[model samples]
Target: MEVATSNPAEETNVWGGGTRPLNASYGKLMMWFFIVSDALTFSGFLVSYGFSRFKNIDSWPIADEVFTHFPFLHGIDAPMYYVALMTFILIFSSVTMVLAVDAGHHMQKGKVTFYMFLTIIGGAVFVGSQAWEWKNFIKGEYGALETKGGQILQFVDQTTGKRVALADIATPIATDRETHLGSNGVWYVSETELPSVSVAEVKAGFEANENVVIRIQKLDENGHKTVLSRAESLEKINAATTVVEGANLIHNEYGNRLFADFFFFITGFHGFHVFSGVIINLIIFFNIIVGTYEKRGHYEMVEKVGLYWHFVDLVWVFVFTFFYLV
Candidate 1:
């Protein structure tokens, strides 16, 4: 006697008569849920960022003025252009990903391979651009002076309209000498290059540079930096440059530490997300080339991944608006 077996293909037959529900495979459902949770996590970060920005509304540095660097545009005030370009690249990659999914629907292997390759290229370029941005930020421009209270103070020259470094203005009051170095006394450890300009150096630079002036933390109702006219600034300094002091969270030579901190954290987190998405996409792309999905006779995997790629692009849209735009 032969035993009857249920057919996998027969599961969808109605009127046998119970119809099988068109259930999404486990992988696709899990991906959807993961994307939703991850989106909430990002939302929490952005909401916190918004709160901080609101709390410090009056003193926050204008985002446009702060991040204006663009590739191949030396010294041009091309604010938002570079980041906009990065956004376009990611969005275009999402488009290609969708097209790849469409081709996979028709079982077009060659087209899928081509589009996936393009997506990978776009992701690589975006990651490289982000690295360049980080380098520029970490190196910093026009540099700020850190106060005893850890605030930042920035210097500007009225004539040059450029940021002035503290080192350019002030000479440090050298301390007592000859408390020399030795393994026992205070062994020298491997040292890293200092990241910021010291406040004393900023003061000396201010005195040395004829065009330089100080911008104090306190501003009038109009939101301008408390400035001294060139002559008055020099006169006040000569009388007593002791007005110079350290920075705090409330005040800093660079502008606001919170601004810097928020910038580093938010963009850094977004960059990390982009990095992970690229890795996942690459894995899928390789699988396509190796015939894994085609052998299964279903391209739903490509569609699912396309959804994720689009979601990444969507997150970047908000990030650009908040971080680089208004």
Candidate 2:
């Protein structure tokens, strides 16, 4: 008989076979590396957003005012409600992922499939809800006037102290307006579709309505926009150069243009991640359905993807806090 001895190697050696580095398999370890790098990227975005917001804290659009739309309840001021539901859906999906991973550990194919299916449904709903939110944000509710200096001035009824939509206040003008089209003008440049309300129409309506007042983009100590007086409103309205109906890369009726820019960039970036996660989940799901993992003697693949799904959910927590709560 011959005595056998085990070779000693540091756990930190990723290629070492004696011990698993960080007590994780190769796939899980790689997933963690990816998560850490992605987390740093999101941290940079948040830090930059914080600095920009601090510089213009007073003038920043209130989250409540900006995210007031709900799924089917039009004209209802249900602020932070829809987004709360979206957050819950993500969190719930994360829970289902945990269950699926546990089921995989037990080699319960049926349970794993069920939980994975639920997770996929949750992810689909979340992505769809995000699309709806973006649509509403871009379309916007009320329109505003853009000055030559690019300042936004919204309309508010002085008596009610509530913001009014351009549709409700704009008087129809009788004039044949020629739209600026790319083919008609310079071939290299093109203009967007015209706004619903015209500058002339807005001016005419404001002049005729005694209750309407000008709300400048600048916010007062109370965090509300600075409402110009009857005399000041007339002077401010005189400087209007264009009619900006909604948000774009250049203009935003909801205060700072940078706010909208950050909103689109960061949220769009996160949405892309969610979309990718959903696609990945679907592939893994199909693999599991086809007994690919069952024949492998283990379900490590499910565990690996669960880690990624959890990371996506965790990132959204920070995003929700910064974009909505804070």
Candidate 3:
């Protein structure tokens, strides 16, 4: 006698009109799908960054030189120190998240709550650090001169081989400077704010300081920015069309405006993800507090959010490698 048999493939298929997929709850399976698609999206962004970086290999900004600012160290030059600390904090938070998930598995609500709280604090600190970084980038440190041909020329001390800020080297000038706003000039064009110093002021300062020379954006044989001769420095500063104080989509004190664009886009996207993960973590935290999951007899929500938090931390690892170390 031939008996009808259930099709295993049909039973396992999620969209084959099956109720449960691979014994996964609908929510868990949906989260997995979202994570996979998001991974692909991040991969695309990083790949594009790599290609662009290779194309602009000569003029790319050095990450250490760019991210050297540390909190409460106004005059200190500590390259990559602060960012390394931020990385450590994030990794430690990931460890706490792992403990949270393990506790959830054991149905230990108290441990889960404590670990989740620690994770939230770590995430908050990371976000705040990122904001500080952005502020410094936007404000800039040592100012550079932008040539008409769209190249940056930084100032350095010939004796010390260290960068000299325009604020320090430039002579004070009193001029009737007016920032042309939309109401005062073209309807579509306006200046955000006048640069702290003018090109004329910078020129006067550079000419007077015999110890200072110009460091053009072009790299030398040893993979360092090329420093011009005293005479060349004078000639190079003459081509200065504008003062580039900080980074923006239009102008970057760092080499290659494209670098700033990609930095903002990729980092901003990742920051948004961290922000979202924190919100979700908070919700799960409250649920655990109210014994919602304790009643339902499972703590799958905590596990799901843990997966997301781990992914976020993992993404930052790649971002820190490429954006800072590499």
Q: Largest lDDT belongs to which candidate?
A: 2
lDDT for each residue of candidate 1 in 202-284, tens digit (9 for 90 to 100): 45667667788755544558866566677766554443321222222233234566766776677778888788878988998
lDDT of each: 0.70, 0.89, 0.88
RMSD of each: 6.0, 3.4, 4.1
Candidate 1 Cα misplacement greater than 4 A, ranges: 1-23, 167-191, 195-198, 217-253
Model 3, position 242, has a per-residue lDDT of: 92
Candidate with better TM-score, 2 vs 3: 2
TM-score top scorer: 2
Clash count, one per candidate: 22, 0, 0
TM-score of 2: 0.94
| lDDT per residue (tens digit) for residues 1-326 in model 3 | 11223688765665666454266766777788888898889889998999999997887888888888999998788998998998998899899999999998899999999999999999989988988988998888998999999899999999999999989888988999999889987789999789999999999999999999999877888889899999999988989999999899889998788888888988889999988988999999999999999998888888788888888898899889999989
Model 3 has a clash total of 0
Model 2, 1-326: lDDT tens digits are 01222554544564655654365677788899999999999999988999899998888888998899998899999999999999999999999999999999999999999999999999999999999999999988888998988788899999999998888888999888877888897887777677887999999999999999999978898887899997899889999988877788889888788899999988988999999999999999999999999999788899999998999999899999999999
Relative to the unseen true structure, what is the C-alpha lDDT of residue 273 in candidate 3, on a scale of 0 to 100?
92
Residue 267 miss distance in model 3 (angstroms) = 1.1
Pairs of residues clashing in candidate 3: none
Q: What is the lDDT of candidate 3?
A: 0.88
